[model samples]
Target: MSDMPPSQARSRTKVKPMTSKGTGESDTGGVRADVWVWSVRLAKTRSAAATACRAGQVRVNGQRVKPAHTVRAGDEVRLRQGDRERIVVVRHVLRKRVGAPVAVEAYVDNSPPPPPREAVAPAGIRDRGTGRPTKRDRRDMERLRGLAPKPHE
Candidate 1:
C-alpha cells in the first residue's frame, strides 16, 4: 500500500453544496424560463428572451409556455436562435452573474436534431427575376443570402 501525506487526505472533502443548508437561502433549484435562457447565455437580453417566449418561440415539456413561465429540475427547454435550435433540461437556477462555463452547469442538453439547411426565402422580397430591388430590399436580400455563402470560381 502507498502512504500519502495527511494534509492531502483531509482536503478530500465532499463537493461543496450549491447552497448553504443552515442559511435562510437554499439553492436555486430552477428559474423562470425566460430568465434561465438569459442566464444560460442563450438569448442576449432578458427582454428579447421574454419576447421569444411571448411570441411562442419557446416551448417547455412539449407545451408552449408564457414569458413568466416557471421551470424546475428535469423540465425540458426548447428554444431557437436563428437557424439553430436547442433543447436542454433544467438542472439548477441562478440569478446572479456567473462565468459561461459555470452557468452551463445549471442545465443538461437534450436537443432535437436540426432541420435541413435548405435555401430559405426571406420575407418582403420578390423572386430573383422580379423587378429591380429597392435599397432596403437589396440590403435585406444581401443579409438573407449572406446567411449561407456564395460559390467561388
Candidate 2:
C-alpha cells in the first residue's frame, strides 16, 4: 500500500476461487441429489431431476431418495428416464455444473449397453405439407408397422 500504485495494490488482493468452473468438487462434503444429477448432465434441468426423484425414478444405494437427499463420494446413484436407465457412482461431489469432460470425471458410469438398432422397429415418416394418409397409404403404413396382415404372394 505504501509503495505500489492503486492498480497493483488491487491486483495483489487475494482472489477467491470460483465454485462453478473447476473439478466439480465443492467445499461441502456432499451435494444434493437433484443438483448433482444436473451438474453431471444426467438430467436436463434441476427441476427435471427433482421431478424424477419425486416420481421414484432416482435411487441412491438401491433406496429411493428425495431430491434434497445428499449424495457423497462412492455412493451409487441410479436414474431412470423413459426406456433408459443410468447407473453411476459418485467420484466427486459437485456443487456447480461444469463442461462435459469435467462432468464425466465426477462420476463412474456403469450403465448397460443400449439395445441393437435392428431390434427396434422403425416408424413410418411422412413428409411435411402432406395431407392425411389415404386408405391405401394407411394400409401400407400399417403393414410396415407389422400391425396389418400380409397378403399372399
Candidate 3:
C-alpha cells in the first residue's frame, strides 16, 4: 500500500487541464440543454425553454425530453432551430455566456443543414382587413397568433 496526502490523491482523480488543450471541462462535462439554451442565447427566456420542450423541439439521448431534463457532459441534444433541427452532443454546461464558439463548444452536431428555399406562404389566406373581424374571428386569430397559450375554458 502507498500512502499519499488526500489532497494529492484527489487531484489525480479529478480531470485537469493540459498545456495543449482546455481542462477538458468543455470536452468532458457541462450544462443541461434547457440551461445551455439559456446560456448560449438560444431562447429569450427560460419559460421559452420549457415551451420548446412542450413543443417537441428538444430531444435527449435519442428520446424526446421535458424542460427539467438534466443534461450532463456528453449528452446529445436535438433542437429545431427553424427550417431544420440541430443534433448536438453536450460538450459542457455553462451558466454564463462564453464566447459564441465557447458557448457552442459544449455541443456536437450531426444534424444536416436546412435546404435553401423560398419561404412558403401560409396555406389559408384569411383577410382581416376585408371587414371588421368578429369577436370569435378576433379570438381565433389571436389564438393562432399565440396571443394566449390556452383558450378560455
Candidate 4:
C-alpha cells in the first residue's frame, strides 16, 4: 500500500559507515572526546564526561578541549576527578561503550600511583542500646579524633 518506489525506500534505509576526519579509515574512526572518555569507562556516564569537559577538567595533549573535540589514537588525555587526576594515553579509538576488560585495552594509564592509606586510630563506639551521645561524650569523641581540645579539668 506504499506509494514510494523501491529505490527511494532503499536509499532512505541506507546506513552510513563511520569514518575518521582527514583519513579514509572506517574501522578506526575519530570520536568525540567526551564519547571516547565514556566509551573507555573513564567516566561513569557520557554526560559526566561532557560535564567534566565543560568545567575545564579535561585536557588533550595538554590543551583544554570541549566535549565535541575529536579524539584519535595516540592522543594524551588528562582528567581531574575530585582529589585525584588520571592521565591516559589513547591506544585505540572506540566509539561505543565496552566492558571493563575491553575498555582497558583502549588506553594506557600514565597516572601516578594513588597515595597510601593512613592508619586511623580506633574511635570510641557506644553500645547498640545507647541513646543520643551526651555533649561531654561528643567532646571526648572529638578530642580522640583530634577535632577538639581536651577538657581543662
Candidate 5:
C-alpha cells in the first residue's frame, strides 16, 4: 500500500545497530579481553594479546584473566611489556581494530612515566671502524654490565 520504491521501503524499515550513548562504539554485551586489547592498539595483534593473557602479562582489576574473558567499560587493564607496564581504564568497548587516534580515545591511560634515560643501562657502542672488541674491552663491558665482579680495592 506504499508508493515508495522497494529499495527505499527496505531502507526505511532497516534498524540501526545499537550504539552506546555519546560514543560511536557498539553496546553488544562486551568485547573479549584479547580483542579489546588489540582493537585499542594495546597489543600489536590479537594473538599477541592472547599470548600476553596466557603468560599472565595481562590483568583485569588486578586479577589475571583469559583471552576470551569479557572486558566491560570502566575495567582496569594492566599489561606488562618488557620492563614497563601499561595501565589503562576502558572507556569504550571496540570489537574491531581501529586507527591509533581512534584507539587512544577508547581507553584512559594511567600508566606511570617511563624511567629516565640515565636510569636505563646503556648499551656498549663501538666505533664503525672498530673490527671487534679486544679481550680487555670485553672484560670492561662485562664489568660495566655487572656480569663480572670488580677487583678488590
Candidate 6:
C-alpha cells in the first residue's frame, strides 16, 4: 500500500500529454481557440471568448472556428468586437491566463491603427433642462451638425 495521501496520490497520477501537430517533437500541445484567446487577454473572460467563437466573431487562420477548436503558434487570429477588429499573429500558445505584460508577448498585433479622435466630428449637445429646442434652435443645431445650410439673416 502507498503511504502517500489521497490528494498527493491523485496529483501523482499520470495524464496523457497532448502532442504538437506537424512537428514530431512533443511539447505543450495546441490550446483551445477560446481558451487561448482569453488566456492571452484578448477577451475579458473565458466565457466571453467562447461566446465570440460561437457567434462567429472569432477567426483562426482566416477561418471561423468553434470554441473547442485548437490553435497553435504562428496562427493568425482575427476577432471582431463591435465596430473594431483585432488581428493578431499567435506567437505562443498558452492555456492559463497570465499578466498583461506576459500576455502581450503571446501575440503579434497586426491590426491597423485606429483613426485619430480629432478626425471624428463632435455630436451637438444641448444644455441640460433646456427642454425642447425652438425652430431657430433646431436650425442652429442642424447647421452645427452640417446637416442643414445656414439661413440668410
Which candidate tops lDDT?
2
Clashing pairs in 1: none
- The local lDDT score (0 to 100) that residue 4 gets in candidate 6 is 90
Which residue runs of candidate 6 sit more than 4 Å off their true CA positions? 1-12, 15-27, 132-153
Displacement of the residue 136 alpha carbon in candidate 3, Å: 27
Per-residue lDDT of 78 in model 6: 98
Number of the top candidate by TM-score? 5
Model 5 lDDT per residue over 11-130, tens place:
888676856554457675788899999999989989999999999999999999999999999899999999999999999998878788988999999999999999877767778998
Using Cα atoms with residue i matched to residue i, what is each candidate's TM-score against the true structure? 0.56, 0.74, 0.53, 0.69, 0.80, 0.71
| Per-residue accuracy of model 6 over 72-91 as CA lDDT, tens digit each | 88899999988789999988
Pick out the ten consecutive residues of candidate 2 with the lowest summed lDDT. Answer: 16-25
lDDT of 4 by residue, 16-107 (tens): 77744422233655889999999888899999999999999999999999999999888999999888899999988888787888788888
Error of 2 at 128 (Å): 4.1
The ten-residue window of minimal lDDT in model 3 covers 18-27
What's model 4's overall lDDT? 0.86
Write the candidate numbers in order of decreasing TM-score. Answer: 5, 2, 6, 4, 1, 3
Write the residue-wise lDDT of candidate 1 on 52-92 in tens digits. 99988899898888977887777888897777778888776
Candidate 3, residue 7: how far the Cα is off, in Å: 28
Which model is ahead, 4 or 6, in terms of lDDT?
Answer: 4
Give the per-residue Cα lDDT of candidate 4 at 146.
85
Clashing pairs in 2: none
- The lDDT of each candidate is 0.73, 0.89, 0.67, 0.86, 0.89, 0.86
Clashes of 6: 0
Candidate 1 vs candidate 2: which has greater lDDT?
Answer: 2
Q: Each model's number of backbone clashes? A: 0, 0, 7, 0, 0, 0
